[model samples]
Target: PAPTAAPPEFLLNAPGTWNLPMRTALASLPRSVWLLGLVSFFNDTAGELIYPILPLYLASVLMAGPRVLGLIEGIAEATGSLLKLASGIGADRMRRSKPWIVAGYAVAGLSRPLLALAASWPVVLVLRFADRIGKGLRSAPRDALLGASVPAHQRGLAYGLHRACDNAGSVVGPLLAAALLARQTPLDQIFWWASVGSVLAVLLTLLIKEEPAPPRPSAPRPDWRPGALPPAFRRYLVVLGVFTLGNASNMFLLLKAKDAGMADYQIPLLWAVVSLVAAVFAAPLSALSDRVGRRRLISLGWAVYALFYLLLGLAGEGWMMWALFGFYGLFMAATEGAEKALVADLLPREQLGTGFGWFHLVSGLSLLPASLLFGSLWEAWSPLAAFGSSAALALLALVLLRRWVGLPAQDGR
Candidate 1:
């Protein structure tokens, strides 16, 4: 059965029920939504623990520089983007999301243990590639499942809560890494621990009761055709591609933290702070999107990103970096879940996996050039040049979004 939409519970005259809307909304969510968030929480806890410190490991331990770091991240993201396109279509055609979801988690889980043995940057790059391939495999189907698990009004709530849960892991993961580093624990030990978290995510994934996929028409050729999707979705992808051209990996932001005179030991702690702030705000911002409108929220989030990028370039002190990073967290809260909800909003129920695949694909592919450009600019001129360029591109994307995304002045959602 389809998930039931919540009935309006607005009652201005009712005593002591000011929170009725929220309570009703919570009551309407499927159990799978919350369970899925927990699964992601564990999986991301594993991933973010490794994310915060990997750049430093590559630079400090493997004797690499900004260019190589950029190269590795760019390639890894590009590889995953390609696979997401394939996996999204596969989930739709196969009509079962759990097997692919399970396989993806298992692959990602087993790959992390190998990172403990990576003495060279090339080895690290390969492992990252493999790990992202696993991410690529699971992302679209997972999103489709989440959308299916809730009603339209509740999508932002579900996705937001999921982001909150996922970022909560990010918060803990970095702090965990910080604690381990402070104890003079070996890097290999941290990687091993990350594997433990990944395994937990896999186990939790097995507990999920996946909703069967809606059927699709048979086509001899692949279902990867972008033109065949909704016109609105296609247009949204266009603006998204332009915006993502400037949105590089958060590893650069971690690198920015280091450049702002944060101690090496403090980097993960700083990351923890960012994740903590994002976790706190993700649900509220996404819920606000449900009340107001997704397009407005998304545009605001992009503007926040632009402002943060510009501020990051100008930051000179540790305190300045701290403030800018907080804004970065706010941007993630405002956009991440809401963006996915907006995509699902724009497309039909049956087209969600494909739409989300295209969505992730455009965003993921843009990271390659974004990181490479930022890294080269850092190597050539200064951090100011790299970040200033990112700000400029982001502003342009914002203008395009405001002017051309074609959202109505008053949307019902």
Candidate 2:
């Protein structure tokens, strides 16, 4: 007997009809996203604990100054950018993401303990490089895994929830470090504790189930050259690259907070506030992109960032710094997840790893110069000059992006 298709009324009315089964299925979809979010939460908690303190450690403890900071960061980020591109291709060739993900975490986890033992600036430099290498290796594959695990309709939500969880960890990590520091815990001890959290993050990666590859209709052909992506994707990457050139390391932002009369202790608290705001808004704003459009949200986020940079440059008091930092979180919430979701929409499933790799590579590679430029401007001129210039570039990028790419409509899910 021939199988009967579903009735036209059932198919057509699916969105309007409040079916319990459909609702349950929709509810279940965000699960994998949330789980991955938990993993990111733990991982970022570990990262933030040390990341916020590293510059102080270098400047005061190791007697290194802004020059060393710029050199180390530039080298580490450049290495990471290249590795991100390579790891993407490797992940696609190996057809396994978990190993790369696990290895990356393990490497970073082990390096944190070494940071505890560093007695000199060079040692710290070496350890930072290792940590960033792990980051470079894992980032693309992990993102690819996350994208593959969820339905296309929910990519924004998935990436947003992940970013939110990651930022939530960022919020908690600094708070924990602050408490520990207040209790007179040694910096070395803090690094050791962060190492424990990193280990736990690596363990969690073991629990994520990779989706099986779809069976090929014929034997897979070897294609050493992965072709170019869609024109929209290429254009989007260019705009992102431009934006990243102005988006230097957050270390500069911390330095600005200090310069703006924030006490040493207050810096961490300000960062915590930023993280909390980002965590709270990330998921909702990302989900909003699904209904409206990613380009609009991303462009708005960039504009907000320009405003924050200007505010940071001009801020004179602690309260003003805090306000700008809080607003900075909103910028991240609007942009980060929506950017990735847009990439997923533009690229084919098989090319995801490469696409993400290139996306990250272009963005990450810009960081080295951006950081150097910001640091040099701060040293040679005023903090206001440095930040104002960055703000101007961001505003320019925003204008160009809007002109070059109109707001994209939601992809038909």
Candidate 3:
């Protein structure tokens, strides 16, 4: 185990937290973290190819509507959320996450081809549910494993690079999808290629070498269960959960662009740019978080989100819509890895999986209602109502965060 600054309360023989390593290059990263980043790159590339186009697919191919899109995304996200918690509990008991990690990549990869055969919304839902089952199984364990590999002080960079690679693939996948769509390639053929990235992700995941897990504590486990997370993490969750209440699925962003007069094929290109911006900024912002503060970076991202969403609600120009898409990407770049690193900072090494699981659960479950509400509002009221309400909620979340969430000054470790 890496050296520690201090152990947490009530855990003897437990490893102390790790210190910052001298980070110099890609070579400075732990081999496992780098490999995992590659795995996320391919896996997310596969996912983004389908995801950016999926709303269009449902609308054009299956004759589904906006509510259908919202329902599918909400259900799929909820499935991942609940399973994340269950898989965390299981991973804690088993003490090795590699098998779950491998299985997740494999299942998600293998399921992509099945989507090609779907004839209706329900079929897509079933396949998506299966795919998210894989995502749920892998997410918490993968995060815990990644968090375990790096020092707490440097975690932002490690996970930031991972998200960068992940969104980098998102950039490539959508551009590729756009190019293919421009040439009039069939959607079914695109789904076939999706499996390639995921398969490579599975193979790459096999290359990562995990440290042997520390033994579980022998004393009777806390009766509060996941409630046993440190006080800081618990408090942070309140703000995180509320913010997620407005973090509707990204599909809505595309739906908004479409409403703003963008063509179906153009959506992929827009998404490619959004992802390109996210990929460009992810590493830099995350590295900055290590220097300044994670909470501040995250709050700034939400502030940007609030501004963008407010503009989205009232904007009249296509160019502004495009600009908002890029800003949306910037928001993701700012928050994605910083939030996970913040969670790691707040918890002990042993409970990292459970901590991430709870984060995923709360965030995703909140998304279900948020999406449902957004879609309902869009249908019953106007796009303005939906986007305006979202902007308001995001602002509310930022206020709550300032009131409740605490960030101690960094030690320059």
TM-scores, all models, native as reference: 0.93, 0.90, 0.92
Instruction: Give lDDT for model 1.
Output: 0.81
* lDDT value, residue 163 of candidate 1: 92
Model 2: per-residue Cα lDDT over 1-413, one tens digit each: 11234211112122123355433433655455556677788888998988877876777688886667877887788788788878877887677787888888888888887898999988987998999899888888888877787766667767887898999999988888888877877778888889767978888888877776675556454232435566777777788878888888888788777767766666677889889988888876776676666777788999999999998888878778777888999998889898898888787667778778888898888888888888888899888888898888888878777777533344422
Per-model lDDT: 0.81, 0.78, 0.81
In TM-score terms, which candidate is top? 1
Tens digits of per-residue lDDT, candidate 3, 138-207, equal 9999998988887765687788888889989998889888887888988878888899898899999888
Q: Per-residue alpha-carbon lDDT of model 1 for 230-304, expressed as tens digits?
A: 776788898888888788778888888887788877888888888887788787677777767898888899999
Error of 1 at 217 (Å): 8.1
Over 4 Å off in model 1, which ranges?
A: 1-20, 214-222, 408-413
Q: After superposition, how far is residue 198 of candidate 2 from its true place, in Å?
A: 0.5
Model 2 earns a TM-score of: 0.90
Clashes of 3: 0
